[model samples]
Target: MFRSIITGSGAYIPTEIQSNPDFFTQPFYSNGLLLPSSSHDIVSKFKQITGIEQRRYVSQDLTAGDIGAIAARNAISDSGINPEEIDQLIVAHNFGNVAAGAIQSKAVPSLASSIKHQLGIRNPACVAYDVLFGCPGWLQGIIQADAFFKAGIANKALVIGTETLSRVSDRYDRDSMIFSDGAGAVVLEYKDTVSTDRGILSASVQTHALEENGYISMGSSDFPDSDPQVQYIKMKGRKVYEYALLNVPAAMKDCLDKSGVPIQNLKKIFIHQANEKMDEAIVQRFYQLYDLPAPVDIMPMSIHWLGNSSVATIPTLIDLVKQGQMPEHKLEEGDVILLASVGAGMNINAVCYRY
Candidate 1:
């Protein structure tokens, strides 16, 4: 059987840091009304709920595609494979290449094509495309690459998730504190192996779009007197929390079951860095589905310092831990892990893999 195996990973965390204290002087608003609460109180509540003390922002000179290409270059180098050998290149993003200080995003060239050009790969056989599946987009790209491998159409693929949420965030909205910018990439190759235990094993994905479609939509700034023509990322915080808490756990359990792996053998979970509390709650419920207590440190978290970078979260987290930059978390041979994410589209997906 042929299996898709991840051979290399890389992440580009923005260089500019925005700490919570940085927002103390900025006025926040809700429903076109200035919030009466002091900035200190609002920031305190935000930190408590999201556990984000700081987040990275792209430099004023960079765009999403630039950073995505940086991460992709690193991943290709890490894989030690010639770029010409790659049969597919997929880039996952939410807002496309939103230039710094701009509200509009451009997708005409396709972020994947841009990144491929930046990487200087000359093979015309290398197909490049983009996937916009909300924050689960990167995983969706990986899933798609795995399908291509199974169909014998592709042997090597490069998958990336990159986003510049800060570029589209409404500074007047308190949810702005939850946004960040980053890029992550991974190289996957199909191997004809006698054993199915290694590489990607099973996966599950779900999207609840009926009433959930508007949970994370774009709207004019919440600040009164702001231009209504300009749109910024708007989210129904409570609705998203409730929806993710309700559905993500079940989807994760379903994927794990499909992998035929026991709960006791699951080593780690690299879940999307959305909200710290919501992620913990979802993991707890997932364990409960197996009638077991959620194990200590079973999940490695980066939201405390990275904030939520939408599509970039999971892949970045995996790259960080894989590179040994995260001291408390590590991935060793024979380790079994699950990658899961939920976001706009109310999309949910999970992948079971053996290292």
Candidate 2:
């Protein structure tokens, strides 16, 4: 069997950080109407509810592809691999700068061309594609890269997840505060077992799309004949909470089972940084279900401060590891670490990696 190894990883966030106080204090009208006298109270309540200290958004001129391209370039440079070695590029995104339909026609191809031009890569054998899987897009991209590598169809692949959620945010809705803009990328390479010490062991992904628990917002039509802007994000917080609490732990268990590693033996567990409260609840339930001590060795979450960066969360964790913020655990050569994520579209994914 072939081993797919992560050769390099990178992430990029805009320099601007918008704290809750700044957001709420700004004088902004929604739908051409001023907020009522209750605006202050609503802002305070929202801040307490989401627990998001701040989030980053790119300048108005920047697009999701721009941020993703920057991160991809960094990952390629860091991997010490020439761009010509990359046989494929996969961009996993939830929101594109253009209309969703426009992306299928133009956006991804433009991004691929720009990256290839900037890197001076001239590989006619390379293929580029885009994927949309809500928040679990990056994980799904990794699984795709693994398959291509195992088939000997590719020697290297670049997988990127980038989102400019701010563009689709409902300015008046408090829920928009939980999302931000960012991009992250990973370079995957095929490696012989004799040459690599770390590689993917197993992966599992599932989606519950028929359920209407959480979904994007379709704009309202006020007049009899008007084009509605169906671009904003809408969600049912309570229902999403319940679904995540139940499904994420089960997904982790499945990955562990497939990899033949006991839950207690995992040195680290990097879950999707959805929210602090949800993270705590999932950790507690996992301990109860597995009959082991809670995995206290897990990294302190970066989501509360960063907000939800959609698919960038996992590569952001990998970036944290590179920055030395992730705690050092005694991970042996063959020990396993679990990466699990639950996202919008009610998707859940888990993967096992040996380090």
Candidate 3:
């Protein structure tokens, strides 16, 4: 049987580190009113809830496409495949190329095209495109690549998720602390595997746009005097938490069931690094469905330091673990793992994969 397998992965982490104390001097607002709590208390509570002590932000000169291409180059080099041989190049991003201090996103040629040009990929048959599926964008790209491989339209693909959430975040919103910047890429190749236990097995994706679409949205800054014409990332934190807690676990369970992977065999879960508590709860509930408690170290988290880089989280986590950066979490041959995510559009998805 033909299967799509990830051959190489890479990630680009920003150099600038913005720690929790960096926001102490910055004022925060809610409902056009200054927060009653002091910055110290607010930051402390924020860390308690989200588990983010610091996050990376790109230097002023960098753009999402730039970082994405760096990651893609690394992935290609890791795969030991010539760039001209790649069949498809998929770039997953939200705010295309938001400048350091700008609210506008420059995506005229599409981020994928931009990355393609930057990489000097001369093959026209290597079609490149962009996807905007919220935080699940990278995984969604993987799903699409799998479809293309099965359909015989492509045999090799490169998927990248890049975001500069720090550029789109509202400085006056406390939730801004959850935003970061990073890029990740993976090279996938179609192979004829004698067994079905070594590649992507199954996936489940859902979009609840009716009532949950507005949970994570864009709006004017919380500071009353800021220009209303400009928009920034905003979220109904409680609503998102509740929605994800209720739905993500079920989606994961469905994917696992379809893959026929026994519950006890799930070695690692690389979930989106949106919120620490929310992810923990979702995984715990996922295990509960099988009448078992969630296993320790089943989930390797980078949120405490990386924060939420939107679509870049899962792939970046994979690259880190693959590179042996995370000593406590490592993938071995024949290990079964799941990749899951939830984000704006109220989209949720899970992929069952074997290493």
Candidate 4:
């Protein structure tokens, strides 16, 4: 049987960093109205609640596809493979390719096509497509690559999650503080192996569309003179938090069970870096389900410094840990890892694997 193994990983974070204190230095507008709050208090509260010290944002010169291509190139380079050798390219993104400061995004041709073009791949048989599963898009892309590998349809695939969420963020809203711009990528290759104990063990994905309406939305209405500001990322923060806390743990536990991976065997649980507190609560509850206390380092998080990059979160975190950029998190041969995410479709997914 064919099993998929990650051959390489890469990430691209914009140079500009937005810190909590920066909010205090600038005026915040909400619903076209200036917010009335002290900067120090706001910063303190933001740090306390979100635990984000800062996040990176693309400068006025970059587009979503630019960073994504850069990440793809890096992963390809790391894999030491020629661009023409790739059998497929999959990009996961929300707003497509938007300029740094643009309010509206354009999706024509798809970011996957743009990335393939940017890489100068000449193979017409090499398929390219985009996945839109919210923050779980990257993980879902990985899952799709594995499916293709197992089906004898592809030998090598590149999966990427890239977003310029800052372009779609409403600075007037509090959720604005949680978003940034970035991309992450991985190269997966089919490996002939008799070992059933390695590679992707299982993946579980579910969507709760009924509960997601209004929980998270993008773009504005068609009415004339509708505040142009309406075309920005919006979220019912409290509802999302509660929904995630209630559902994500169960989804993760079920994924681990399906993968035949005991919860305690995980070397690290890489989850969507949406919220520090919410992620903690979810992990804690995951342990509670198994009647075990949560380990201090079971979950490796980059959100405290990187903010939430949606689909880019888990892949980027994995790249950083594997590269030793995240010193506290390390992966050895035969190590087990769990990747999971939740976001806009009210979607939740988990992937279990051994590396």
Clashing pairs in 1: none
Please identify model 2 stretches exceeding 4 Å from their true place. Answer: 26-41, 98-114, 194-197, 213-217, 220-227, 325-335
Candidate 3, residue 175: CA error in Å?
Answer: 0.5
lDDT of 4 by residue, 242-332 (tens): 9998899999988899988677678889999998998999999988999998999988989988999998888799889988998988899
lDDT of 3: 0.94
What are the clashing pairs of model 2?
none
- Which segments of candidate 1 are over 4 A away from where they belong? none
- Candidates sorted by TM-score, descending order? 3, 1, 4, 2
TM-score of each predicted structure versus truth: 0.99, 0.87, 0.99, 0.94
The runs of at least 3 residues in candidate 4 whose Cα sits more than 4 Å from the true structure, single-residue gaps closed, are 29-36, 219-230
Top lDDT prediction, candidate number: 3
Q: Per-residue CA lDDT of candidate 1, range 273-349, in tens? A: 99999999999999999889998899999999999998899989998999998999988887999999998997999
Candidate 3 residue pairs in backbone clash: none
Candidate 3 matches the true fold with a TM-score of 0.99
lDDT of 3 by residue, 1-355 (tens): 7788999999999999999999988889998999999998999999999999999999999999999999999899888998899999999999999988887999989999999999999999999999999999999999999999999999999999999999999989999999999999999999987675589999999999998989999999999999999999999999999999999999999999999989898999999999898899999999999999999899999999999999899999999999999999989988999999998998999999988
* Pairs of residues at least 3 apart in sequence or in different chains that clash in candidate 4: none
For model 4 the TM-score comes to: 0.94
Give the alpha-carbon lDDT of every model: 0.94, 0.74, 0.94, 0.86
Q: What order do candidates take by lDDT, descending?
A: 3, 1, 4, 2
Q: For model 3, how big is the CA root-mean-square deviation?
A: 0.8
Tens digit of lDDT per residue, candidate 2, span 1-355?
Answer: 4688777888887777988777656443445455564656666776666667888887766777878888898888778888777898888887665432231223645455555565677887778777777888888888888988888788799988888877766665556778888888989888876655578989989888776434543443222233354445666677778888888888888888898877767777777777778877887787778786586666457776678888887887776675566556344467678888887777888889976
